[model samples]
Target: MEQWKKNLAVLWVGQFLVMAGMTMIIPFLSLYLQTDLGLSDPHETATWAGIIFAGNFVTSFLFQPLWGKLSDRYGRKMMLLRSGFGMAIVMVLMGFAQNPWHLLLLRMVNGTISGFNPASVSLISATTPKERMGFAMGTLQSGGIAGTILGPFIGGLLADAIGFRPIFYVTGLLLFLASLLAMFVVKESFDRTKAAAKPNVSIIQGFASLSRIPQLKSLFAVTFLIQFAMIGPMPLMPLYVQELHGTAVNLAFWSGLVGSAAGLSNMVSSPLLGRLSDRIGQERILLVSLIGSALLFIPQAMAGSVWQLLVLRFLQGVFLGGLIPSVNALIRKHTPDGMESRSFSFNSSTLSLGNMIGPIVGGVISGWIGIEGVFITSAVLFVLNALWVNRTLLAHRKQRQG
Candidate 1:
């Protein structure tokens, strides 16, 4: 295989490991907080879980651009190593946490060093051919989605077998192994001398330069909105499952199945949509996905059974599979040469921003109007994003035709 192809394969595994480690806690976070950490009050436990979960994203959003600037100055591979190793250590430390506050602090620190996803995206963007950007991004996304789909299932088994704390140790070890793979296998052609020769721009300057590009600016906005809408229902999903399935013997298992359903279809569909985008255009795939996903969310909000919700979520994943790959490919297409890494970094920050804010908003919406309201809110946001993309991007089609 060619070098870019080789990078994609190795980085695909790297993405899987990183994402799995990150997502493995999703299924049993409350269990860990309540059972392992000795929290008695249900409301306090829920609040703590939300805090611990959101803390990582809060720091990650603030720090990603800084890392991106550093990657532009150093190299993408080194940044990957930095994140991989740092996250590995943090994951291990979480297993040893004596209390909720300890775990919360460690999570905050983990966010400070989180950039593996963006670093990998930068490496792939730099190396892959422009014509195959969509396919490359989609395939890369599939690895993470696969991990996300499997993490909770595996985590549940492990939690039952070895217990909750051990899960963190295993996850951390896998991340370390992933880092080792990246350190030895992945190669990049960064030249520090040339990077130094270029006038060094401050991190803010770097962000400013990219923001000034109209297409990049618009793409960034759409990326944020997309994440906001998609993730808005996540924090409340287990409760929604409970509301649908009711308190039962297998409540946890059913919730895990519901959570993994969307990821399964997303993993199956991402690469296919990406290839189609490569042939036709990313804009077209993105438009259809935005509209389709918007419509799909409505049925999910109105789903009468857990099975119905599962099926709706799976289809929702099928439509949204094209979303991120298209966004990344569009960024790669619009970014100035030599600045791809920074552009991806900014894009990653928006993603982190969505991750941070989406759950909070979802939590508030779920509290105010109930869990179903969160899905309705997500549907509305998706429709608005579709309109935004149509207004901003499709207008270019007319200009090109004229």
Candidate 2:
């Protein structure tokens, strides 16, 4: 197999472990807070859990660009190892946390060091043959989504089997194993001498430079909105399930199924759609995906049963699979040489921003317009993003052709 293919295969495992480790602890966080941290008040436990959970994204959102710029200057593999090792230590310490504050601080620090995904992306984007970039991105995405889809289920079972504190230790060990795998297996041909010789651009300047590209600016919005629309409705899913199910016996199971249904299809479709994009054009795949996802969201709002919602979400995932891989491929196509990592990093920042803000905005919107309305709102956002893609990407292509 080619070196790029080898890197993708190794990093695919690394990405899966990293994402799984990160998410595996989530299912039992509240339980840990209550039992271990002794936060008996339901309100306090809930609030602490929310803050502790958001803490990672908060720091991750602020620091990703800095890491990106550093990766460009140094090397993506170094950054990848840095994040993996750093997060491993943090996850271990969380198992030893004596209070909510300890966990929160460590979670924030974990976020501060988190760059495994973007670093892997930068490395893969840098090494993969340009013609095959879409398929690579899609395949890589499937790894993360697969991890995400399975992490909670596995975590829930393990939390019951081994208890909460030990789970963190297991998560840490998994991360360490992932780092060790990458250190020995993944190969990068990054030329640090050439990277260092390039004019040093500050993170702010780098952001400004990337932002100047018309297509990139639009793509950034697409990245943000894709995450925003998908994640915004997530928190309300259980409540919506209850509304639809009306005293069903396995409400939690149905809710979990609903939540994960999209991811199941997303993991399966990303590589397929990515290959399709490479043939038809990334812009075309992106536009059709945005529109398809938007139209599907409208039906989800009207879903009469949990099963209905589950099917719609699974179909929507097919379209969701196309969005990010195409976006990443386009970002790679448009980003100037030497700034690839920084550009991908900045895009990662927008992704983290969307993750951070989506839930809050979704909750606020749900309060105003109800759960179904949140789906409509997400639909509208996707529709607007499709228009943005049409104006910026598709139209640009036509202009160049004409």
TM-score between candidate 2 and the true structure: 0.99
Superposed Cα deviation of residue 218, candidate 2 (Å): 0.9
lDDT of the candidates, in the order given: 0.88, 0.93
How accurate locally is residue 260 in candidate 2, as Cα lDDT from 0 to 100?
95
Per-model TM values vs. the true structure:
0.94, 0.99
Pull out the clashing pairs in model 2. Answer: none
Model 1 error, position 219 (Å)? 1.4
Candidate 2, residues 198-314, lDDT tens digits: the string is 999999999999999999999988999999989999989999999999986998899899999999999999999999888888999999999999999999999998889999999
TM-score of 1: 0.94
| Error of model 2, residue 323, in angstroms | 0.7
- lDDT of model number 1: 0.88
lDDT tens digits by residue: candidate 1, 1-402: 888898999889988988888778876899999888989899999889889988888898999888988898899999999999999999999999989999999999999999999999999988889888889999999998988777767887899899999999999998999889889888899998898788888888988888888778888998898899888898688889998998878887788788878888999889999999999888888889999998998988888999999999889899989899998998888898778788998999899899878887998988899888988898888888888778777777567769
Give the clashing residue pairs of candidate 1, or none.
none
Off by over 4 Å in 2: none
Best TM-score among the predictions, by candidate number: 2
